[model samples]
Target: MQFLEDPVLWIAEWLREVLLGWGASELVTNMTLNFLGAFVVGAMIMVIFILLTWIERKAAARFQDRIGPNRVGPFGLIQPIADAVKMLTKEDTRPKGADVVGYVLAPIVSVFSVLMTWAVVPFTQKWIGADLSVGVMYVAAAGSFGIVAVLLAGWSSNNKYSLIGAFRGVAQLISYEVPLFLSLLVPVFLARSMGVNDIITSQTAVLFAIPWLNIPIRGFFVLAAPLSVVIYFISSLAEVGRAPFDLIEAESELVAGYHVEYSGMKFGLFQAAEFLHSFTFAALMALMFFGGWQGPWVGTNNLTGWLLGGFYFMLKTFFFYMMVMWSRLTFPRIRIDQMMNLNWKFMVPVSLVLLMGMPLIDYGLRGQELWLKYLVLFLFNLIVGLIAFAWAARADRRVKTHTRVRFEGRPVAVMPQAPAAAEDETAG
Candidate 1:
């Protein structure tokens, strides 16, 4: 009670002093400045999302060997704006049998959920919306609202395909959430706190005046265990419903899937929510695995820290986002059965092993020689990876052989007819 008391008064007093020192007014001027700062940050995040959509489309087009939106503006930079205008002007449609309220509200729910999640994410040391102690858990909880919205969209549409897509979306997200949590637990455990700021602070290198072989090495989770980084990335991709994990929106099978009945700006809102969600997850992953707002040579100054850290963070997130896009363009979408099997058979087991092994490895490396730990981790990864590859190859060979059928009957070949020009010339 004592510790929590007078927090507002303390902040006000500190602000009053700072304002007086700067030759400004007590309360109104400081409040106005704070509000302006928050508004600018929010606006910047929105702008980043718009640019991200353009970048994604351009990247996808380049991957498929085609020119993407070059007519709207320079390199089609204004394509997203045009798309927004078109969606806004288009006729809104609702199917006759659809549930009117839920059908209309679902997209708004999804977009609102996505935007709310952004409030907890810190852009810099000083520039964050809420900065709650439970920031990470807040994000996780808020993200699940999209699942509710998707399910509502599907069920209220009165479409079988939409319902099936919604089911797929829920199942995939739930299954992948397990691995995501497990992988994320590594960082949280190391940080010793669930707060996002604490996790970032924990990434600083430990410096001691004494040199000893048994000294604990402090660094980012990515440096400590690269496997968790990989697992988190893969799980996040599945969470976002990107291919080859995108069975939820399988166009050939489900005809636009859960959003089948949505039209005009409503449908556009759903699409925008999806892209925004993906961007948010990518940023979260960047903060977790890569150093959040921490750069190599730059110290945490207000402007430089925000820009450089944000730049590095965006660069890392965009790289992963492009990888997701590449997989979407390069690989075929898996069947529903294959998708479930992957979660149950491969990702679940691998994530479990990693979850258990990471702590044990950390314990073993705590006081042991560095070279010995490296050697053991390397050997273990190499052996397991080889066995997994071999098993996959053998399974693939068996599948090919089982699917191949030999025809016993004699082959009958049809020859092409001779050209009419040859007959005409002979006749002439």
Candidate 2:
């Protein structure tokens, strides 16, 4: 109880008088606390990323009906640590013709960009690191640096395969960013704020229930626009380069892709960044759509609120991570053309329409009954979801019967080429 009552107050006091030799200003003291808090948060996130990697491997193993990483301490709990050690001790080799500077800088850039995005993510009311007014924009902007690093890694390797892989990555991420932003805008519009903290606080405000139905229709963009959430999840999957969207590292075609020439800890950095990006996106998705830091069945008491909020945030993020891993293990890698088609044709248009339509619907329901609002929203989403599901089912059926064949630098249907036109024509 005492420990919970004052976590860092004692340390703060000691640092103020002993280290600074004077009482610190409010800004300085707060800054110090923020840094300390960020450090702890950052460390926890890193550990979560490591654990998520193991979870992914185990999940993938289960999907494939194989045992994965079971030898390293209790169901492979220590597998990540062992992998880290092996990476640390292994030889760091550079390709003969590779550009040393860019080759060395790429992984650092990738990891750093991912870490920078975390700076603006608010864990709780008092636990934000920076609390930038443009928090979402900052996250979006910082995310692009990773794409740059990937491109550089591929280009500087002086390898054709790496260059192609990097180009694929650039194309995938840039195209998906459109839908990603569109879906993200739904929450920002509903909250009417650019700050992450403000968005979270907005979600906690309660709206009065309608007299008859008694459904409280307030806060939570997810309840308001479920389609946006679905779009955002799909766009995020592409953005993070996960399965069905992992053409950038397609083993069969690209031969390990952008980091083909990398080895040792350098390559380890890329792998870490991949896991980190996946984890970070999951966290962002939770924050945006799931009322981040909102506890499950908890009152608004200070300590309970903070702890529960963080717990819920982590729980949702980890669950999403599991979903990503499940998809990776269960689905085959989509062809590059199919990837592009899905993004440009379906995701972008649907996201844009939802982004525009949701706000209008929300506005029109300003003075309506809460039940009416929810009913309308639910019906709209249900109709759209049914349409999408039907389309997907039809596409799947087509894919099952379609024989994939490539000819003359393009994919096509050969239809068995009509049995080579029978040489008996000459005998006639």
> Judged by lDDT, which candidate is best?
2
TM-score of 2: 0.84
What are the root-mean-square deviations of the candidates from the true structure over C-alphas?
Answer: 8.3, 5.3
Show pairs that collide, candidate 1. none
* Predicted candidate 1 versus true structure: per-residue lDDT over 1-428, tens digit per residue: 12123333345456567777887775666786567556665677668778878988898889889999899989999999998889999999898899998998899898877887777776665456777888778888887888899899999999999999999898988888887887787677667778887887777654322366555444655765576677777778788888888889999999988999888999988887887777887778777766676665435654466666667767777777777777767887888877776666666676677667766776777877544554555455455546655776787677667656444444768656679769988999
Q: Each prediction's TM-score against the native?
A: 0.78, 0.84
lDDT per prediction? 0.75, 0.80
Q: Which ten residues in a row have the lowest lDDT in candidate 1?
A: 1-10
Model 1, residue 245: displacement in angstroms? 1.6
